[model samples]
Target: MKSLQLLSFLLLSYIIIPANTDGGKKKEALESQSQHTRTKKDQQNFATKFRLYTDATKEDCQIFYNQLETLDKCSFNASLPLVIIVHGWSVDGILEGWIWKMAAALKSQRKQINVIVADWLVSAHQHYPIAVQNTRYIGQEIADFLEWLEESIQFSRSNAHLIGYSLGAHVSGFAGSFISGTNKIGRITGLDAAGPLFEGMSPTDRLSPDDANFVDAIHTFTKQHMGLSVGIKQPVAHFDFYPNGGTFQPGCHIMHVYNHIAEYGITGIAQTVKCAHERSVHLFIDSLLHNDKQSTAYWCNDIHTFNKGMCLSCRKNRCNTLGYNIREERLPKSRRLFLKTRARMPFKVYHYQFKIHFINEIPGKRIEPTFTMSLTGTKEDAKNLPITLAESINGNKTYSFLITLDTDIGEVIMIKLKWEGTAVWENLWDTVQIIMPWTKGTRRPGLIVKTIKVKAGETQQKATFCSQSIDNLHLYPAQEKTFVRCEDRFQGQNRK
Candidate 1:
């Protein structure tokens, strides 16, 4: 009975507070209407609802409290940590989707901690634009609740964590911003924050590093392909993770209409876009569940450089683990970090950086050729993984590529580099193309790779491979395997 009364009081308190407006109903109506028209600050809806859950499928942990007094009676320990899960723009609010799966994962991961799921169905049920405006109000209300918790129950704000998806990510930011005192919350995890109107908003307006002590964000779907990208591509957090270049996820692409319908079902037809966007949430959850198969991302200027083997060095807190095990202490304030993950669960894979330099020049005119390689490491051997030449296989300018080797080949002792076809046209054509000007030969000819330098992304070790003396792989044009063993170490001094 007391819980019911407090909920009613809390619900009533959330009524939209205008940011200092005129008294008359005429002025209020005009102000309300104008908010829907003008910029961000004009938004007035301040009310929000909060629901607490401690179990996977039930509200059963008996923690259902939006009011201060009920919080005391609820199944939560003030001494333990608090995690608030906030959902974003939807007609159903926290009725289904990420919030449910995330809440269950959190409960399973940390049974002792308090997990509260914020539900503001009334405001969220509106159209897209209206739902966007509601984020501010919802954010502040959650903030106000945290402040009350600090005052009434002596709850430590630093012990609280906010994990939000899309617009809710901004809401988490708002809560962190509004929570009183200089000390902010422990952390804020953004699962693909909304990309729409919040894109260019100020630090106070959307999710920013200022919102928390350590803010981490994941970008699963940033740019729009078929449907619009609800998530932004920008780096709003201290550590922003761009998985698979932050554009397209591997398995999210389903071509056929009926096949997609049959798989996702009619109700889940929107999975086309949501699947990639929602992948961030699952990635985070996977990190919590499977610590053994944790994801790793490197420190690079951008995804392009990350794709190349250039920025594989983890110097001065450069690289970081993806998801729940994310160690902010081991990571510097990088604007954009890049990583690659598998299509399904257990998304961990080994990262390798191969740096190759071609000694014998293959004329001018740039052309990317395909080469197959074999690496005989200390423990095992990785053979025939196709390597695409980034630049023309010529000169001393070292070209690099970041590739994932599923099994750890351990310390790479011997490396064999060979072409699938006789790249004779490459050696003959680049010079001929320059002379002829309008040359039309289309074969990627061969070149002598004197010695190759390789760096392991995981181990940070470097190795050099030289051509085998008796059985040079280059001699056999389209032959079988090449035996460029560790013993075949032809130092660059011999070639030079």
Candidate 2:
């Protein structure tokens, strides 16, 4: 009886062990198949490829470029709107994930936008002129390619969009302006037009907007301030992004540092790619395919206040506290210059004066500061406005000048001061605005105004009037008053 029982037990153990082993093998096979299914679906939905030029050089950002190739190109309707993106200065084309992400996000909604990720250069260096030239070359190439595409594939350039980030934006401007094709190029988005170089200077000082007449709309982002005395004036870009008040990022030292990680770092890059993908895939297609002229608008309070009426989008947002628009009728016809005037009036009054002074650190050295103001518009030729000097000294002496400008109704007067000295020191001709102390007064005389410097740069020889006019007041509210309140409610402090 014992022998028989032992044999039966062995038999049962053999049967159970084989059965369990087969089940485990089947589970492993199922898991593998699931992974393959996911990968195949992702690839079929999005086509991602990385192409390197035969002569492309090696650099720190090569890894980033390699990663960019993996990003999915989100499309809608199997046919998508073409987006040509250019990178900024010192930026290696390796970090394409952010752009891809953005494209994908846009595609999910629209699905008809196609993205062209351009790696224009292999190295990041100090070749500013070379960079501009290369972008121009790329632009011309696209133009030629577009001509062929329209003839062969029946594609349209009018529906195409160009997004240039930083230096890339500048490059796109150069390219799109010269491209030869049907006038299909509709929008050129400039994310944070760089440099204090655009100050009071003329088009000769930098690249002129005429380089790209194909551009119908522009959006800018500045690090220090928003709006400028010169550049594309009409159909000016939507609110310039002041993300963190034009700083590299916003917040304290720690927060700013972390922002870099999130913005320029790998994780931030991933997020940006998703965003680009979605926007390009979805919204881009809808706009291009449907021929919608509307574009998303963004603004900063500082730009709105500084530009006043010059920035059409900002004028729409009714924030009058930070020096609003100016009406010509309410302005004083001032050939006269004064520091302060005290009287009572129906409108609120304010006045301030910033005495210009030169303080020398050295015991004995002469600093002669020169000032010049010039204006260029299509209606009029470039005109020079004289500056009335107040006082001057040889070495460590102080000087003051009074330029009287009346506050037009709803408008704040602004001035740009540039100074040049014969010294090797830093912090010279920076930007200063006319600050009025009477905005709080219920009834005061002529407004008191003072100039406060905003940036640190070597002094040059120009001060810009950079003023805004306020002709229309009730435009937006007239359209939709209730939606205005709910739509434009203040979220928090925004500056740049």
Candidate 3:
């Protein structure tokens, strides 16, 4: 009866407040239009948390209140620390229930900790900048709320820890940076900071500890292939968590997908409702705080200096070790090479082949050669050198060919290629230019040109360059696997 009354009051408040705006109209319309809109589960879910807050949009602000309600409703002690669970991009508030289960398990043993489930609506399919802007706003709101809470509700910054997942991690960091208004974050755990935005962007572009002292991260994975940039810098997340090698729930393809649905979807939702407040991450946080006592301290302490003296020394190191710098006068782009030009010549030499297929439809297809340009001074003849194309293609609709020419160092090779889907062998060539690298104090008289010909009805393909110049080879993206393990901090030299 009490729960029912509380829910009715909350629902009435929602209905009354926005009675004028379009939002209110939409709310009323949705209610009126509801033939079978929300399920019984959703109704029970709303009832479970409505007593704490009338506004679902302000769930993050109401999280603390929600935690207190859970304690009283479930009859738990109220003197414990608070753990806040922050969600990520494109994720709904449904995750709060999963957090609840995790929190309940921890609360079973340590009644000294409460759970706070933070939530908000982020537009789906929007890019990083959009998310960042909203997060900055939310962070400011949170900072202001915390200030008010400290003044009235008697909540101390020291008693709170924030765990932000995905873009939520970025938002949490942004919030902490702003909240410090004077630089004071208790602890920040980033579950997998959004990948693309952080990829090419500088730290100053995003949030950082330079604004707040207590900041760290635990990246589940760092690549966002679907975003503008595919790779993310390491130091972005202080202490990145690489579960199954930092991926989206590891296992076979089907198994991994299944796990995500179960873990993040169903199971996650259940836990949040059950725990409702400081879900289950408190123990891990406690361990982290215990291990890094120095970072946990106020930033003013001299004992908590740099290197080993820091609470989040690993993260500190990681921050310093991010960013990729490319030098000018060097190759700026990577490419695949098909022909190696070294000697000087008079006429323009062009070598290319393209076989087009199915180009009349809404989508088109073709198979062509890729080319690249490089200059060298090696004593190699420009003759019938094997022009390697696609090696052993699968389908019958595939194509390949090679062409060699008589030329010398310090000459121009213009390789022109066209794809017409009529025959098997479509010989093509390039426009030529004069080469004079040897006449001047230069490193080479040979220029290697690489290119790729992609067509419809075929898988994408690229031509590769091969020679032996450590510098020249390094000038482009390597064809083989190469990863250099370094300190999370950017101290060690890159090994490729």
Candidate 4:
């Protein structure tokens, strides 16, 4: 009985521990190692892991592509749209979290998609630079497989979309370049393409717009670490979206670190460090799930201007969505688009640009005042969003503040405005105020409201909000009415 108990313990231990680090985490292998592992006795000679899943229902009917397949079980349905997903570096090239999630998201939207997962787990296990080198060889192998499919099964590369993350992005790009002509790849979405070894490399050596007809890239981590970053900062694609300034993503902080710790103990640190790096995947997922709530990113010179609200205008073709369903044809040439986002899931935000032109009663050095405002829609309300000057309020020019509301507030119905401080502190550099003496002797140092122009970025909705109360009230931090919304085009307010 004790011997049997020992045998049971061994069996349970083998079952509980993953065969490899990322192994068995997926429901079904893109190419099942149930038949053979890439690093096994026979596959020791192999350089790549290429597998096709044309139909999700047919889990047993996987079409594994070997360089030596004579069009036997390796045939694919040429009519369906093809999406090839490639992963970055890992010890075992087993499919990780995003791989399965993205596949599920894609399959959810479309009826038929030939989603092939490129698994190069064995070749991907080396040091960063070494694995970076191997991506080229792996890409070539992928290209060879595509060529084989095209020739034998009449597969069209025009219907192909390669979605690659980190180093896998480079692999996709290399593959795109390898297979030439009018029958080239349709699109490539690079999710935070690896920044270390392939960042500044030649376009031929890495993912580039030239590789595919339409290339959209999401760069979530690009902050320099010594001489390296986790994702490429360059606008390599025709449409490169740098969500949340494109460096340190919002939710990648101590809370996520704690969550990771709770999930996997000390080993969760691996994911914690890559929170920002891995955000691109989640952003893409959000785009798929919520098409109606799809957020638009603006084409801007810098994040500062974008945050300031100068870049919120959807003039001509200035903005684009940052996900899988991004308009394949609309956005032109190349743009490093910028946008603000929420820290958590369903990470869409409603963008608002407030343009306020201040009229001063006493004009001696216009003190830019601190202000807070609230918005009340039909269903819900947003409270106390700080309104700031986009730039130095020169004379009576309009100042813009680009702000975002995370929740759906229906149609904005009311807006409440409040002003603070005696002399409006303009800049951090200009004002170093510990305390301010009360407005000295009847100067009446306050602002006279002239025009308020507001635009909601999502709806292209325009409305002007003006205070009916004494046009220039004392800068007393609280307005009698806190919510201002329009009944028709421009008229609604709430008091007390």
Candidate 5:
């Protein structure tokens, strides 16, 4: 009940106050609109502006629509690639700090690129319903500017790349739809595209693969609340990436809300709701910063299969990079890729799939043992990682499970496995031993694990691990064993 009340309070606060502190003027603008109808002049009040940033001008230079002189003043270069960044709904009539940060990052990464920030805060500052309705008009306005650029300066649309966040993602789609055929935009990237009124709408209405020559989306927050999601739940691009299942992120927990509150006061409450939604932006920024440590996402039917270590294969376009370095592969159908990321920046992590087969010495005997693994590689060592099993280990049965390590351990050279037995089960086994006289002299229940198979996601490397000493292959409760890389075939071979 407290959670419900807190959520209600947060929602009410979000509607009452804007994202930033400049809510007084915005509230007046929103209140001035007619409750039943909006006049054409009122709609036109929400105009669009473009700000250009380049290597020559680290600071932004304002560019106006149908103003060729403004482009010359801003030193706009038609020869270089034009990258445009569009933002989503804003309760305040101001661009967020991330807009400037992203513009700076783009300029720093590519010296020859032209960065433009499409500012539509005037229309976006109104009530959400009005803001949603204005996306089409804002999109048309962007198209008109692009069309003018081409006619006045002989600019080619093929050199344009649109990166839009939230509602702006759909705005880019609307812009693309207006300018079609031989003059399509080079690419469009949707960062957690908005879901309020766009979910389940046709492709023509929302951000779709047809919006540009290539379209990709990163979904960070899609959990539903009152039958609506904050981010679009459906695939809105050619390659849709659901990092950490797209429902919840690693660090955006209830506790983090308090942390944000402490940092930004009441405005922090709004940041709490946006933490996961804004992760899409940071993930893209990470791609730009960490070129060598790019994250990899694999194609999977569902998150369930990927969790079981079943979909790590990268055969035939099964996997691709997560962000800026992603390969542009246009297929007849959209592809859904899944991956796990760290809580903070430099979010890349190493993924591995471990497959081990257990053989019981005693017939019909099964054991539910807990395991902890430590891996040693050429680069570093990861210690005491817990291994979770879905079910009990049966005789001669193979189990596959996923494991993630924060740092790259390089090529895995050795693994240490420890078996932890439950006290209740151990006591029960002692009673059984005393009752069965035949079992009194026999060896205690043990499992034989000769070899293990491993696969790496980023490098697509496969390895086989064999017991260090064949004589001590039996693994009993409260025992530990070591396995090292060896040449062995795990398939179709009988376990001894």
Candidate 6:
């Protein structure tokens, strides 16, 4: 009986011990796998990082989320206003050079201000669609960091200004959305906000006026290619500025690709491709560097009306400075402002509308003559500027065209108009007048431009130019006439 009991105990121990050991090994393997997953997730969450730039630091200081100690180490001053710059999608994992350039510019402008560059290259350096999706997660992380700052250091949300480019603009919007009520972000400046997925979405779905207390957007590359716009076309903020009609920029033509390559080597390919889109970033930097020469945009119903030079009025907040100097006024509805920019830096250009009434002395005749105009202003003279007319000038009709000058010629004082026509047309007109002596008075078949009405966009100044001598006003082929600023006759005259 003792041997039998001992045998049963031995057998049970062998079976139970092996089973328990196998179960323990399986549990260990599962726990290890779970731990690895948790670690990877934590790393992914922490990938979005902040780099602080201040006057005190020659190099950027890394800032960690939920790490209050990092703030002090980074020389972050809660008392000063904070400007956060968020970048967009990246093909390469490395951050672009513009990030540092913008940070330096911001620091240079206001030494006391804090500039934090939010970097999410780890995720942003992926497929465009994936990078776009990562924006939401990165934005949430930014909001969490801001909340940490507010709770830890009592930083005021109103002192925070977010400047985002491309997809990052929507990211900033997402961050702003996370904070509600009195803690909303003070301002968000979208530098050519990305379009693809957000273009026709609801205001709540993308960057809108409601995203921040004062939201402004600059659209530089809204022109569609392959049925997709690189920048958002719709007004996504309280103040939406469409520079150069928000299409093909002045210097971003295909010919510039070669010029870019000459200047920047192989990398110029990317630069040329993104020149128009990246222009928004440079424009913002220009505003910081040249505050005195800030670009101004006028509120207009559409670019067509703006191009007609009818929206140059500065009355009742119709005009606002673009970029850093933008007015923070919030209207009940979005205001689409339009402005023209130059090809290079100091992009501000002077817009002018020339309204010339042409009187064709010859009956039943229309003259299609080329015009060369020069304006003498208080400051300087813009000479040999060509005026392009879409159609022939008819009798008793006013033709209005828009022109832009890179230099501010100040108040207009004098104007010179020259008419150029083909030699055949000139000879034919002279022969008709001489042969048909019995027809009408001795007046020739020429254009009689009585007055040239001018409207200055930047200054919102209007002036009238009259020929120095009424007899010389008859503009014939190869003839030039001088006009000086005269009494305002345009007030009562019809203008289109």
Q: Which candidate is the best by TM-score?
A: 5
What is the Å distance of residue 440 in model 2 from its true position? 27
- Candidate 3, poorest ten consecutive residues by summed lDDT: 321-330
TM-score for each of the candidates = 0.79, 0.36, 0.37, 0.79, 0.89, 0.87
In candidate 5, what are the lDDT values of residues 114-171, reduced to their tens digit?
Answer: 8999988888887665676677777777776787788899888878889999989988
Please estimate how well model 1 matches the true structure, expressed as its whole-model Cα lDDT: 0.69
How close to the true structure is residue 337 of candidate 4, measured as C-alpha lDDT?
Answer: 92
Q: State the lDDT of candidate 6 residue by residue for 201-250, as single tens digits.
A: 77655788988889999999887644467788999999999998997578
The CA lDDT at 414 in model 5 is: 98
Tell me which of candidates 2 and 5 scores higher on lDDT.
Answer: 5
**RMSD of candidate 6 to true structure, Å:** 16.1
Pitting candidate 4 against candidate 5, the one with the higher TM-score is 5
Report the lDDT of model 6 for residue 232: 87
Runs in model 5 with CA error above 4 Å? 1-46, 55-57, 360-367, 422-425, 435-441, 494-496
Q: List the residue pairs that clash in candidate 6.
A: none
Q: In model 2, how many backbone clashes occur? A: 65
lDDT tens per residue, model 4, 274-383: 67878998899888888777878988998988887778767877788889878775244678899888887788898888776565544445565668877878779888
Backbone clash total for model 6 is 0
Candidate 5 Cα RMSD after full superposition onto the native fold (Å): 4.9
Candidate 2 error regions (>4 Å): 1-80, 91-93, 123-129, 181-184, 196-221, 224-255, 258-496
Candidate 5 matches the true fold with a TM-score of: 0.89
lDDT of 3 by residue, 179-274 (tens): 644536566655545554455555544444442334554333332323321113354533332322223222112223344447767544322221
Which segments of model 3 are wrong by more than 4 Å?
1-79, 91-93, 122-129, 180-183, 210-212, 224-233, 247-249, 252-496
TM-score of structure candidate 3: 0.37
Q: How accurate is candidate 3 locally (lDDT)?
A: 0.34
TM-score of 1: 0.79
Cα RMSD to the true fold for all candidates: 9.8, 25.2, 21.0, 10.7, 4.9, 16.1
Sorted by lDDT (best first), the order is 5, 6, 4, 1, 3, 2
